[model samples]
Structures are given as C-alpha cells and as structure tokens.
Target: MSFIKNYIEQQTLNRRSLLLLSAYGLCGMTTAATLGSGVARAAAQNPKIAWSYRDRTNPYWNSIVSGGEAFVRSLGKSTSDLINLINEGSSEKSLSDIKSLLSRYGSEVALAADPNDMPNCRPVVEAVSRAGAYVSTIWNKTDDLHPWDFGDNYVSHMTWSDVGPSEQTARLLFDAMGGKGGVVHLGGIASNNPAIERLEGFKNALKAYPNIEFLAVQAADWDTQKANQVMSGFLTRYGDAIKGVHCASDTMAYGVIEALRAEGIEDMPIVSYDGNPQAVELVTKGKILATVFTNPHWAGGITAALAYYAATGFFKPSAEPKEHREFYGPTTLVTTKDAQVFKTKYIDTNPTYDWKDFWSLGKGQIKYRS
Candidate 1:
C-alpha cells in the first residue's frame, strides 16, 4: 500500500515542481535543470513499468494486458506509460526485446513477463539481473529457477496450478460421455508448461475411468486455426468413435468447435482451460462442458506491481516469505452449472482490484513433482 501511495506522490511531485518552476520563469535556470535531472533519475529508483508476453491476439493475453493497463491507470499514469514487449510466441524475440529494454533502461526497468516458454525464462531473468533491473514472471519457468536464488532483482513468479483444474474439466467431459468413449486431446505447444500439465491432468483422469479410451493427443500449438486443422484430422481418423474432446486452452477449443461443425458433429462433448468470456458463454450454452478461469487480469496487474514496487525499493523481495516470492495464481472451474454466475461477476464486469495487495489471490506456493 505504501508503494501505491509513494508512486502517486512521486508523480504529483514531478508535475508540481515543473509547473512551479515554469511559473517562476526558471525553465532554463540551474534550479530547473536540477529538477529535470531528478526526474530522469527517478528511473534509478522509481523504474519504468512494462509487461512482456506473447501477442495479444489470444483473449487470455489480451486480458493480461488489460490488467497491466489498469494498474498503470491506478497510479495516475496513462496506459501508454506501460511498455509492451510482444514476442509473437518466439522465445528468441522475447529475450531479445527484453535485452533491448535493459540496454536502454538498465536498473530502472521493472518488467513483468511470461518468458514465452520455460527454457527462455532463465536467459530472460539472467539478462534483467545482470542489468540490475527488477522482474516478476508468470507461467513459464524451470523448476530449478527461483526468485530467491537471484536475490532482489527477480521479484516473484506467479502461475496457476493447471493440473487440478484441467483434470476437473476432463472428468466433466468423461462423465458427459458416460465414462465409456474415445476421447481425444488437442494440446497447446508441446513444450509449454501449461500444455504439459494440462495433458498430464487429462491422463490422470484417464486412469480413473478405465472404460474411456484415449484415441489420440496432438499438439495444436494453442492456435485456433491449427487446432481446427488438427481436429479435422482427428475426425477423418476417428470419426464417430471420438466422443469427447479436451483442449489445452479455450482458443484451441474454438478451432475444435469449428472443425466439428464442418462435419456436422456439434453434439460431441468438449472441455478446455483459460476461461475467456466467449468460452464461459459457450459453457452456458452447453457447447463447452467446462473450462478453467485463471483470472489473468488480476495476474497481469499484480505481477507488474510486484516488479515495480521492488524496483522502487518500496518492498524488499529478499525479505518477503517464500510463498510471496513463488506462488500459484487463482483458478476457478467453470461449468454449465455456474457459468452464468461466473459470466455475470467476472466476464460481464471485471472486478476492480487492489494491485498492492499482491498475494491475496495467490492460491499457495507452487509445488513441483518429484
């Protein structure tokens, strides 16, 4: 909370000092010159805020950026003040763009990022750390990576525990199929953490229902078009034998639906993750049996807030508890049963959040499998 107050005060001081100097006809005087330099040096303490992630074409990423913009607005700053570094799903581009910012802003940069993939997280965090910048990450990091390991520069990491939620959705799909049918999965990028865990959850559910047969699982790269193509191929191969579909994300589910529609197979049961508004609506319509809502809006704003506050020295990451440093974001299972309520509360009207209350929505510290 002090961080929010301090940020507002800093902005106020910057404006008030400039106006007072201009009124005194001291724009070119030594006093005004010093004030200007002070503002420039605010970077050394205050930092420039930024969010780096895959492109906003995906509804999930767009919601993430919306949250980031909301946090900027809360600070009495324009949304334009928050820099966006879009990687277009390329880890190379993700790291390069981050390094470019570090070269320009150095320790004055506070970055909240999704490293594009797990392997890219290390290099990205290393670049920021070497430049003495502050960073908070989500969704992609190797188990070996830790904020505490890098000291204060790596502020925190937040991610949803997708396994449980994905399994819950899968069980819903299996039950819809009467626990005995061929189910196929259209997954995200094979290497993505969510993709891996989501598929793992599907597999876990498969174990519980011995009568349900897994026809096939394919990587769709989390792209709607690609998922559509994959689903089409599955139809050609499995046809009426495929009774249910499990998608890694809602975006992919959209593609699967179109593929099914093309073949007049609209009645097939389906489930997915990342509860975009459209996906929630689909749930209400019985189009998608279930999906998981991860609250990317709050995740986006709070991740950036963590980095910004740490960069400005309002909070010390090193002193915070482990749960605050590495934690799971909130996750909600949305099904036909409560999709209407979810749509009204979370989809129709996004909730206002206290960005400074960083860990209120965190489920718990991230747990890794041995």
Candidate 2:
C-alpha cells in the first residue's frame, strides 16, 4: 500500500495543477471548480471498464492483465470492478463476448481490447462506436481503419514496431552463425500484426546475408507446444543444415529450444521478440542470442487508461492529433551483455509509469503498403 501510494505521489508532480485547470486529471482528482462537476458527472454515470483479450495461459497475456489490474487500482476501484472478457483464441467468440459486454453496460462502458486477429478489430470498432461505448485497442487493427474516423468513441490504437527490433535480433543471430548458414523461423499467428512484422524482419535480415538461407518458416500461433512440434519437424528435414533459429516470440522460442534440447543441441544461435521474463533469463544464460521487450505493463495499463480517461471527459479524443490517436508503443532489444540491467529495471522491479501520458505516446502509427 505504501509503495503504491508513494508511486502515485511520485507520478503526480505538476500534473495535479494541470488537472485543476481542465475537467481532467490522470495524476489526481479534478476539483469541482474545474469544468464545473464534470468529473463528478462522469463518476455518477459509472461506466463499466472492461479489458478483452485472448486466454490467460500465456505469460505475456498474464503480464498484460497485471497492467490492466494496476490501472483499475489507480482509478480507486477494485480489480473486480474491471471486467475481463477472455476470448480464448476464437475470433467469433471474441466478437460475441465484446458485444454482450457493450449491451450490458450500454453507453456507460469503457473497454481496452486486442482484436485477436487483424480483421476482427473492424467489427469491434463498428459495434463499440454504434453502442456509444469508448474503446482503445492494441496490436491488431487493420491499416485502412483509423481511430479518428470513429470520432471520440474510438479512443486510440497502440502497436509495437516489431520489425526494427526483430531485424536487429536476427542480425545478431546471423553474425553469431558467422554470417553463413540456414536458419528455421518459428512464427506467431499468421495474420497477426506482430507475427507478420517479426517474420518480415527475419526476411529483411536475410536479404543482407546472401550466404544465409531461410530454411523454412512455420506458424506456431504463438503457442509453445506447437512451436516445439514445428521445430522438431524442421530438425528432421533440415538436420545439420539448420544452424540457427528465429522465433516470432519468446514463448515460441522456448518450444524451439526444447525441441533442440531433445536432440542434444544446446548452443544453436536463436533470437526472438517480446522479452518475457523467462526469455530474459534465457538471454542471460546465453540460450537465446537476443529478444525485444515491448513492455506489456505499459501497453496494457495505458490502453485501458486511455479509454477510461476519454469516457470520463478528461480529454476529447477527436481534438487530439492523429499521432496521439494511433501510435506505436516503445520497444527495446535485450542481448546477453545488457540483460541483467533490463531485468533489474523492468523484470525484477517494475518501473513506475505515469500511465496518463497517452497523447504524446508511441513510436509511430501503424502503417501498411498498398
């Protein structure tokens, strides 16, 4: 309790003064004098806050959920107050569940969701907007749709620029392989944005290394067990020809490593993304060549806070610039040398973030080529 209170106080700074001037205050409460009871009105309306995502079996999703729970606490609400809608990997079920929540909460609902699939985001946006509920999404929106198009009800979209970091990790693997060898790649869900970008990153790195051949690439759907099986098949086909492995995520990397271990191969150069805690340990012990951390804590917390703030009339999303509405979240690469420092700051002890910093956020907006 003391740590949380001290953390919130540290986050306040001058933001508290800013809240007094407007009907908003992410740092603290807005006075009745500011914007004439707007905050009180927002509270009275009591918008039901909910977070929707795939199942909680994955460690990454569990971390994301922790961030969501933290945001609920920041709002002076119990974790129970933040409704959870787990889709369990079914796009149809995800849509059905989201619609049900919107119907139940009516216009007084604020939601943060990952669309499960790229195309699934569209119907969600349409439904949430029509129901007059505010929503913020992360990771899986289509390139054609813009949050600004749906006005204030669609608060923002957050995604990580996985290509840069993934490519960087790939290069590390290639260099360790003496810049010449065939490598198999284990990828995530086929149509998912991060999965696609990470695979593209591996291919892009391959372009720079003429001697290196991409032996094969298969979708693990970001599942560990599936990755293990996929990697075992690759080993049977490629054998000693495969010198390294690149995975779209750490979870898949774990499976890939296990498959290699079964064959008594422990030193194969491997690289992956989404610097999960276990992955950092793997990197630390030289099991993985590199990984990229997107800070799910920041991603999940800010995604929920964005919708909640918009619903509370803290800020009008329609008034904010395009970058604020749609932007890429921050990411960092983790290699063996610096893995310990990252573990201390991010993995061991969490960084205290001012989650209300939504507008001037992200590395860039989601872009796609025609």
Best by TM-score: 1
lDDT at 337 for candidate 2? 97
lDDT of 1 at 155: 92
* Pairs clashing within candidate 2: 328-363
Stretches off by above 4 angstroms in model 2 are 1-44, 359-361
lDDT of 2 at 137: 96
Clash pairs detected, candidate 1: none
TM-score of each: 0.88, 0.87
Prediction 1 TM-score vs. true: 0.88
| Per-residue lDDT over 184-274 for candidate 1, one digit per residue giving the tens place of the 0 to 100 score | 9999887789999999999999999999999999999877778878999999998899999999999888888888887888788999999
**lDDT, candidate 2, 1-370, per-residue tens:** 1222232233234234422322121123222211211122342156788888875556688788889888888878998777767776778867877777765565677899999999999999888887777899999988988999988889999988888788899999999999998998898899999999998888899999999988899999987778879999999999999999999998788778878888999899999888888889888989888899989987888999999888888888999888888888889999999999999999996677787877444786666668
On the 0 to 100 scale, the lDDT of residue 332 in model 2 is 91
| TM-score computed on alpha carbons, candidate 2 | 0.87
